[model samples]
Target: MGASKIGSYPCEEIVVDIVVQKSEKIFGELDVPPSKLYTQFATALALLAEGKSTLKQPLRTKDTLAILRAVENMGATVKRTQEQLSIWGVGRSLRPTGNVIDVKNSATGIAMMTAIAALSPRVSVITGDAQLRARPMPHLLKVLNNMGLKAYSTKPDDSPPLVVLGGDVRGGRISVRGMNPSLIPALLIPCPYAKKKVEFLSCGDSLQLNLALDVMKAANVKVSVGKKLSIPNQPYRPFNLRVPSDLSAAAPFVVAAVLTDSKLKLNGTDLASDRGAVLLNILKKIDVKVEVSNKFVLVRGPQQPRGTKLDLSLTPELLPIVAVLAAMAKGRTTISGASEARTMKSDRISAIAHGLRKMGVKISERKDGLIVEGQAKIKGGEVDGCNDHAVVAALVTAGLFADDKTIVRNRAEALQTSYSRFISAFQELGAHVGYAE
Candidate 1:
């Protein structure tokens, strides 16, 4: 598939190729972002609390920073240092800045911030960059309207530039049957501020659902998540938390170690509660050696990875790199249940498939997933990043295992949207990575 204009976005002019060379050995310890969702949720809750909240070790990527800017725009006092953030929240009395909140490239930022904006009894507009505006918005307008907030999309496709005339909401019953589970926090975060108790008539299961419940727990909000769930009308309490490292951000490095037959360590993550537990199990299933400690995970790559089936219905963000791992494995690998990939900033399934197929891997793209025939080694070639961070990182990782130099062009800027230090980290691990001259 040829890269289209929409695939380039604002990143088209940036035009830098991430150069990677086949590595005989790749090893290092890198600090991954504590969960991006955790950071954004914590910030949103902090904005709703009465007292000051202290968050340690939060991920400071472009996306998370956009959320922080939105929090500040919504009348919260934010103090920052090198390692920690202190936010003095406005409680239920949120003040609007009388300006548009532009979340740039963060889909997560816009969703959480829109809910926060709706808590104020005034008009608020939320917008984003082109790529972010192209991503799908959750079907929450009807639910928000039912709760006394008027929310609508300016675009027919329900893309961003969302307008909300919001205020103190009258909470009512909602159903999560058709809603995207990753966006559940947008609904849950604002429930405590509603005039009445918010009740969820039905709840679907997902890792994000569990993470939302976890975030609610830490913020001292009362939530019960069974077949049906409810959040009582109360105040979100200010919290002190050390955010857990992001497993999705760590995935590329893990796969790099696996593909290179090297040992690597990832710091500041707790597998017992992290969303990466499923990825870890998948790694073991594919015959990778993994050791878990309280604070770090140690991974040893196999000489030849054994291919297996994967279901990424709940964790679509991991699909791109996992697909790369599958391409380098010893046999056929099938990935299913990731229809959500189509709704992201890019159609990640198509993007990754096109990139890998260009590198001489046999891949068939599916509506929701992929079927990849593993090769001992694939040919090095050029691939477009398609203005997606995960796809860029995945292509770079695939480059490490290719037969010669690989060049990933377009949207290298997308890396800053999530993992800001991807190139430096790869270089530190002794992998050959550089900008194309």
Candidate 2:
């Protein structure tokens, strides 16, 4: 999946350049876009359901398109509309083309799709973009093999391009670290279709499994969860659902709002949302003023952020923007429990530390997290986006509060992978941002 095929921003150059924000404060109501993360996985799961599943207002982004194509390749009939996309699921009866599926830069799509492909009696090769290919997949591949898929990575380190010979899942169990985002769902989604009942032993905290379960529950698949997971062969029953606004997308604004003398009302985002809830907790712990309800999140900022011991155990995607907030805060901040971020779209912990340091931030990077002594004002300069969406977004958020000109290169294009409306959302909140036209 090339960048151009899905209408992603040009890969070679900075297509849209943003100027460093002058002293500005954003205030207003913003309707954050629906969650592409949930939309992609739910759409994939819908493709495996027994009947028509309607996804109302699903995000129309390059990343979700990657997963949609994966499901399309597996024989799901997709009907598109302005307000909805309906997937006529083939359920366990996938007509595998035995063709190689290109996921471009979405690691989760490939992982979940590979699990679905293993249920078919065909050989499926899953590949992705350079960054996606470089990500760690062997851990998930090893677990897939234990479930009897014969899944293997073409690369030595168990990275993609991954090869899976699909036939039958023997429904065995495997123990693994809890932090691999793609591992649990990749297994849980396919295990039910296995010849026998599947038991998955989570070697660490399996909180992410609850998300997979949430998607499963929405699709009408029952998964027994406790210390270990018990997956029974229950057919996915299709249903209509609307995707909530993405909290990950809303994160930059949250941090931005906190740092500026701004008040932001975020619509379409819910307090009960998994990502939003985590963010809310973190803000409260750090003393940022936030009020959230089931329908909206209201945030007021310039609250003088303070450094507190933080654990990103459940929400590692929070790392980038959290790093920005930490850099702007006024004390020692320790971020831990997110070492798994190393395998994401970028080496996030390093990317955050290095990129912020480029802006004159004092920071120390650990294997799992970061330690930062906050500065009164960030002396902004130039930083690289590392072609990671979160990295670019984080940097952009940082720029909103930086002291001087901060030129972020190559990252403006990364917004296509997650939130293409990032700049617009910021601008809606009265940010002084624009492309280098």
Error of 1 at 212 (Å): 2.1
**Most accurate candidate by lDDT:** 1
Q: Please give, for residues 46-128, the per-residue lDDT of candidate 1 as tens digits.
A: 99888899998887778888999898988999999867899999987888787599989987778787777778877899999
Total residue pair clashes for candidate 2: 0
Clashes of 1: 1
Pairs that clash in candidate 1: 34-245
- Give lDDT: candidate 1, residue 365: 90
What are the lDDT figures for the candidates, one per model? Answer: 0.80, 0.78
Error of 1 at 44 (Å): 0.6
Give each model a TM-score.
0.94, 0.93
Worst 10 residues of 2 by lDDT: 1-10
